[model samples]
Target chain A: MPLTINNYADGILHGVSFEVQRGENLIILGANGVGKTTLAKVLCGLLPSDAVNIGGMIPSQTYSEERAKRINYIPAKMEVFDSYLSVAEFLSLSHFNQTISIDEALSKLNILHLKTHSCQTLSSGESQLVLTASALLHSAVYTLFDEPTANLDPTRMKMLFELLKNDTTLPSKIIITHNLDLAYRLGFDVLYLKEGRVAFHGSSEAFFDQTHLDALYGSSVQKVNNHVVVAL
Target chain B: MKKLLLLTSLLLLAAAPFFGQIDLPLDKLLQSGTMEHQVFFELRLPRVLLAFLVGGILSLGGLVFQVVFRNPMSTPFTLGVASGATLFTAIAIIAGFSTFSPLFAFLGAMLTVIVLFAIAARFQNYDPTALLLVGIALSFFYSAALMVAFYLSTLQESYEIMRFTMGSLDVVGFNNIWLLGMVSGLLLGLVYHYRKAFQALLTSYEFAFLQGIHVKKLSYTLLFGVSVAVGVAVSMTGPIGFVGLIIPHILKTLYRVSADKLLWQSFFYGGIFLVLSDLIARNLGESDLPIGVVTSFVGAPFFIYLLLQRKS
Candidate 1:
């Protein structure tokens, strides 16, 4: 397990105990304002001020400085550093002695043409890709991507999941996503959140079961052929 | 890299004394120690040097403030620290307060910052925008107090207050230069030692924490550096307005770089810009003018242009 919570007596995630295996991809599913993002923040150390309201050991005591580097997150709104430097320059400045060349990162993401582009000049789509490349620049352990599917093409979604699986070095990953459609393709396990509580910890196959699917979204579902549609 | 730039700056500064309406030859000036050279050294050189030094200090201080606050408009004035210094300076001029009140100005600047910081502490979430708003209010309050002080003062002192409020750099002799040099060296050293912390500030606290930077300590360090820079600057030049505000803003927008790159760049460019501007201020007309007027005349319009550019 890459993460373990002790004596977590918060409201929603209260006494919640879950272990994620190495190289595992977990999808957090919940509507807006539920504890999905909060959990993500806590885990990645972007926790809000009243983090104790959710209960657990506080950040200063719970995690040491070195252990903190284990999680890298892409926040909801990425910070845009306005400078003359290009995308390459920004990544180089991020805590790395020998940074990977911009081309190497871009080629890995199949976006090598974006090597010379200024980050400020990129579209949201292209900028998100630059952010992704930056995340992988150092082979960072336990990369946490918040809503990776947002602003991404279908093939890129498939590419991201494949990339997660390809790292045989056993780096745990957490993806905070609401797009259940991508669950089958990207989700290894699903943490269903309902009203700030982790309601279920199971597989995507549960989405295929009519009873469980209905129970998953807490509504009725109809199975037309192989596809299950929820009437939420 | 900085050394090379420092050398170039020195050469240009030394050459400054030789170029003017009444040019002094190199050999003749050195042998006789001409009155013009002494005038240049005493009347012009020190003022220009102090302007450069203070400009560098202010720009560095402003750069750090904007970055830590993560807002483009954040500055010592925007944060109310400038008003703190200004309040005391006004008291010195208008209320028969002692002229040897730079220490009072320093305490005032820090105290005002501490007050705003304490109030902002209630937000606890580090809502920088809200803190920025609080700072603006504090500035308005202090500025109002200054105007009231003006209302109560004698006419001569009131005019002196007004002139000083606009910022003047007309001091003479070696003692003032030495004091400025000592403070600049101290502040510059502090800034460099915390270079990495400055970089950490540019990112989110989580990122900074993950990178092992103590955000709380860094925040205090930033406040200290800013107060020193603004406090000393306002004391020396009597609230030099735009050097702190405009230099860092123009530099950051132009460089489009990280806080670390822009931090040092702002210092160098600010020093160069202020020295050149002060030289012009000293000899632009028949009589000398306050350094702040030249800066504001140029900076205010340029600032407007920047806002327009940001708009469309």
Candidate 2:
């Protein structure tokens, strides 16, 4: 069944509703404080809500493998409370997907060398990469990523972009990002939020149109050579 | 280094019962009906076992509390469990029910646990920091009540309450040992059963929730288990300090592993630490030192050293 949120409302999010069908991907775009992360949390049941449903079951109300296999949410930052928890150990905890091995996930992210390093000691960029690797291993039906590329270098960003574009890496990805170029390049459907409301929810073609971009961004965004770019 | 530390700990545990103030001759220890035999089996052995069991429980409880609260400074007593026990013990002395102080202490601890959980249930969200603040406030309230009890007591009763607060491991039989053994075993079994869920928690609450763990239910279950075990411990031993706060940290530093992987290590070393402290407290003076004082005296400097070393 499709993942659907029917008029979900919480603090800073007012009557936000959407749907992501099976095998469909989405990109959530919004300015700072527009409640993109909060919405992602609600959709994934981190912030419990009766409005979110996946396969006829409320995401917030389900538990155990049923919930885990249906949905997963990766936060913007990796937070490990134990000082001695290693990167490999952290990844192992997310290894619910029997098809993907921990070693394979680490290698795909080019972080196999950091397997034994304590997660607390990793740089932000490294931590982000580790979190992404965890998502690949998690392999939930609907995986929501909040600002996945917020702390990556240009080269690593390219690698992650390719990984996200690949259908085999994950089943259905709902990415929350501020990087308009990355969002445009993926060519996925866009759901834009403004002031806790959905400003636009349509195909990338319609959302990235010059007139639409100008309307939403006040002429600061340009579609040059078929690529979306900001004036700044 | 880890191996050396473990070996030293095992040796200390073995040698602890032999080093008390009144020496029991080795030859007479095994001979039934001898004074040495009576002291060895009836006094020293029981006391050492009590120390070991209490130490293990407190340290393991500390680890669980620190993980659940996500605060390094948190201990088994962070929820005012010890303060509740202490206050009740003082009340027992004032009420002339000193012989049943353990029962009163247990009641106080369980009452605190119930109050804390009741308040926690009223929150709209599962917030550890709010629960922590409530615990701190309850501790302050209990302290005030204890002061009133002290004010109403006679000089001898005041001394008795003071002694209980300082902590003790003076047992004469194996009765309490069996009870504590079962409690410690239950705690160990519960923790081990939830090791994977606990490791998920070490990442973050939200992350653990995403992993299909009922974060609120799991945390409450673990906390309740620890509180019950610690209540029984404090009721019996009067709340020995430092072992809970320091053993988990020390084990983490030495083993360089996740807290989930160090459960057995924490329990073993915590037991050894108390045994060694009790040994020193027994043999170092004319009268045995308070177990709480000895733990603080040895634990504080070593803990500080570990902290400074970690910083560098």
Candidate 3:
């Protein structure tokens, strides 16, 4: 069954309805303070609500491993309470795919050298890679990544783009990002949120049209060589 | 450095039962026909064991509390469980039911746990800060209730309450020591079973939840187990402070390991730390100084030094 939210109303966002089927990735776009992160939390059952469902089960109501296997939400930043928890140890906590070891995931993210490093001591960009490594190891059916490229440099961002575009470990990826260029390149169906409402939900071809870009971002954004760019 | 610290800890534990106000000469005690034997076995041995077990309980409780609450300052006593016990003990003293003081203290601790869980259940989401605030409020209320107990008490009853609050390790026999040992074992067992879950929580609560841990249920169960064990300890030793707060931190600093790995180590070092504190309390003065004063005086400065060292 597809991930579904029917008339979900959190104080920050109201009358929200959406569904994301298996193997169908989606991008969530919204201006600052438009409740993108809040929606991700509600969808992942971090904030319990009766308005969301996945695989015929309400996410917040189902406490079993089945619910966990269905969805995972990766926040914008990695948060760890223990100072001495190594990156490897943290990844091991989410290691559900037996075939892909912690070492493999770290290597895939180019963070194998950081395997022994304490999670608390990692730089922000390094932490972003570590979080990506964990997502690979988690292998949940539906994974929602919030600002996955926020801290990455160009090289790491490209690596993440490849993973997001082709990785089959996780069946569905709901990416929430402010990077319009990356959003355009990913070519996933877009769900643009504005002022706690769905302003646009359609294919990338339609959402990235010059008129639509002009309407949404006005003179601040432009289309250059089929790539979304800032007007500067 | 690790080996050195372990050696020092062992040496202290060995030397503890020997040095006290009334020294028990080994030769006389070995003869088995003197007051030294009785003193060594009945008073000294039992007291040291009592202090160790209580320290272990408090220290393990501290580690669990800090991890579960995600606040470094959270200790077993932070949630007012000990304050509840202290208040109830004072009430027992003033109400002339001193013999049932332990029962009253346990009841008070359990009551606080129930109240905390009740409040937590009403929230739509788990909020550690809100729960911590509730605990602080409960502590303030208990402190006020204790003041009322003092106001209504006779001078002798007030003195008794004061003595209990100061904390002591004056058990006379092996029976109570055995009981504390069992309690320590139970606490250790409970934490050990949940060690992996606790490690998961060392990450954020949201991360832990995604890992399929019933974060709320696991936390509540661990908290309840710790509260019961700590309540038993407080009823016996009357709220020994700082041991719970400092020992886990000390071990974390010394070992430089995550708390889940230091679970047993925290308990061991916590026991040893208290034994050392009690040793100082016994030998430093003519009359026995209250154990609580010694722990703070010794623990606070050393803790500050460690913090500074880590900062630099």
Candidate 4:
């Protein structure tokens, strides 16, 4: 069964609908304050709606391993309340796959040295990497990442891009990002939200076409050598 | 540091009963039927145990409340449970049902818990802030009701209510001790069983929910368990303040570990802190000072110091 949001409407979002079949990845792209994050929360059941369904089960209704195995959502910034909870301890909570160890996920993100660091003490970029590491260990069927590279430096950004492009870590990734260049390079199916509505939902090639880019972003965005870039 | 703290805690627990107002000589205490033996066993020993168990319950309850509410200032008392107990105990004293004050106090606390949960259920989402505000409002209401009780009471009844509100640890036997011990055990067992989920909560509610924790259900279960335990403790001790609020904070600072890892530590240190406070109250002067006063006197400054240290 597919992951589906059948015309989910809320205060911020108008009528949002989408579906992702098993093993099919998706990219959610939107400008600021367009309800991208809100949609993500609704889809993952944090906002708790009957509109979101994962493999014939509503994410909000399911519990324990049955729900955990189906979907996960990684927020932009890692928020840890306890001052002394280490990164390793945080990652262990999401280690359900058993295929990849916490150490492996940390090393993959070049964050093995941060294993013993308290999660509260990590820098924003470092914390983002730690969150990404947790998603790796989680290995859920449908993992939605919100602004995964928002705080990353260029090197870490490239490292994460490689991981996401390879499609070997998580089975079906739903990445929400404002980085059009990254979205274009990933070449996944795109669902663009404009003012809480689906403005565009099609292949990345079509979404990134020069005329389509001009219509949406005007002259502020352009393409050079098959790479999407901002005019500035 | 942890080992040293543990050793010191054990030493305090062992020595608490001996340091009270009427000192019992060791040899005299050992004899079965002497006044010293009776005082040590029937009065001192049970009082210390009572203090410890109540402290443990309050401390654990505080830890759980802070985690669930995501606010460090939160404790079982903050939710008006203690105020409810205090109000009912005052009402009992005025109504000439002073003998059944504990029962009345417990019913008041449980009734507050039921009311809080009922209001929380009406929330569209799990809004802890709204619930906290409701708790504060309930506490204000209880405080006003307590004033009315005082207005209606005789002078002697008012004094009795005042003493109960200030809190005491004057149990004469092991009956209440056994009941408190069982309550403490049940609370500890429930918290221990949900330790993993509790750790997830230490991250955030959203993170815990994403981990398949049934965040709302788990939070409610833990809150209900803690409320019942705190109700029993307040009924027995008449709402000892600061032990619940300060013990968990102190343990967290000393251990430098996540709150979940400090569950047993919070409970143990909470017990020890109260026993120590009681020791000071007993030895300070001619008449024993109130247990609540001792806790606040010691807890307020120390808590402020910890906060200042954290800032720097």
| DockQ of predicted model 1 | 0.36
The DockQ score of candidate 3 comes to: 0.78
After superposition, which runs of candidate 3 have C-alpha atoms over 4 Å from their true positions? B31-33
Question: How would the candidate models be sorted by DockQ, starting from the highest?
Answer: 2, 4, 3, 1
Give TM-scores for every candidate, taking all chains together and pairing residue i with residue i.
0.85, 0.98, 0.97, 0.98
What's the lDDT for residue A81 in model 2?
98
Which candidate ranks first by DockQ, i.e. highest?
A: 2
Give all candidates' CA lDDT scores.
Answer: 0.68, 0.92, 0.90, 0.91
Q: Write the per-residue lDDT of candidate 2 for residues B117-183, one digit (tens) a residue.
A: 9999999988999999999999999999988998999999999999999999999899999999999
- For residues A1-232, could you state the per-residue lDDT of candidate 2 as single tens digits? 7999999777798888899998899999999999998998888888888998998889888778788888999888999999999998999888989888999998888889999999999999999999999998899999999999999999999899998997586789999999998999999999999999998999999999889888889988998887777787
Superposed on all Cα atoms, the candidates' RMSDs to the truth, in angstroms, are: 4.1, 1.0, 1.6, 1.2
- Compared with the true structure, what per-residue lDDT tens digits does model 4 show for residues B1-312? 789889988999998899877878899999999999999999999999999999999999999999998898899888899999999999888888999999999999999999999999999888888989999999999999998998898889989999998999999989999999999999999999999999999999888888898888899899999999999999988888888788888888888889999998889999999999999999998999999999999999999999899889
Candidate 3 structure, TM-score to reference: 0.97
lDDT of 4 by residue, A1-232 (tens): 6999999888889989988987888999888898999998888888889999887889887778878888999999999988899999999988898989998999999999999999999999999999999999999899999999999999999999998898587889999998889999999999999888898899988999999999998989999998898987
Interface Cα root-mean-square deviation for all models: 3.5, 0.7, 1.0, 0.8
lDDT for each residue of candidate 1 in A40-138, tens digit (9 for 90 to 100): 666655553333221233444333445444556665454554444466655654434245565776777787776666656777667677777766763
Model 1, B1-312: lDDT tens per residue? 556766876776666545545666666555547786676667666877787778887777777777777676666677777787878777876656656566667777878878976886677554666877888898899989988988888888787777777777776876778887887778777878888667656655665655546676677677666776677777777777777778887765665566677766777777876786677776678776777888888789998899788679
Worst 10-residue lDDT window for candidate 3 chain A reads A59-68
Q: How displaced is residue B27 in candidate 3, in Å?
A: 4.1
Full-model lDDT, candidate 1: 0.68
- Alpha-carbon lDDT of model 2: 0.92
**Residue B299 in model 3: shift from native, Å?**
0.5
* Residues B101-168, model 3: lDDT tens digits: 88898888889988988998998777878888999999999999999999999999999999988999
